[model samples]
Target: MKKAEDAQRLLRTLSTEMPEGWKKDYAGVRNEYRQAMEDAARQAALEINQTDPEVIEQFKKLRDDLFSSLSNHQARWPVLLLSEQRSVEYRQSVQAFEAKHSEFVRFMRQST
Candidate 1:
């Protein structure tokens, strides 16, 4: 019961902090990529004719490009986190924290 309560507390703290940490850690690059993607999506939406197959393909391409850009932006975080020299003793713990927090995040996203 005590362990369960501790785990629950940890989950709540982690679920909030992890995303905040990620935003703080990568806000500049992430926001830049997001802004670019949103701008391009908006422009494409205005010009795209959904009924035409060629236009539809172009929209798909735009989406893929956005995803690729975001993916590249996001993929840098783990490497940075792992190699961070400030906490040399806690690298394994950091990895574990990432895994656990990721699971919590995934569950929250799926549930909501």
Candidate 2:
């Protein structure tokens, strides 16, 4: 859990960097981040389910919102999209969503 949070932060930092080495992998990073968030959300739900089902149910909505937002922004960047402000914002939003999701999950763990 703590490890995931740390890894997420590192990934977020990476997302903020220029897409030099990853010229064609910017979208891949976003997609992979989305996938990782979904997995984390699922784990969080499972953890919460042990105590209160409804409490964990909220994570699913957050997860859905994250994916929907990411999907809408996918490949919608300017021409020659080599990672710009738009990508940065989208990545940041995804990071924020994950951070909140992780916080929620951690809180649940503590309470449980």
Best-matching candidate per lDDT: 2
Off by over 4 Å in 1: 1-26, 76-112
lDDT of 2 by residue, 1-112 (tens): 4544555565555556754664445445555555665666667666555666666565556556555655655445422563555556665756666656556655656544
Clashes in model 2: which pairs?
A: none
- Steric clashes per prediction: 0, 0
How do the residues 4-106 of candidate 1 rate in per-residue lDDT, one tens digit apiece?
Answer: 2344355334434565454344444334534654554555565556577765665566455545533543464432453324354454444554454344333
Error of 1 at 16 (Å): 32
* Cand. 1 TM to true fold: 0.36
How far does residue 43 in candidate 1 sit from its true spot (Å)? 2.6
Error of 1 at 63 (Å): 1.7
Give the Å shift of residue 87 in candidate 2: 9.1
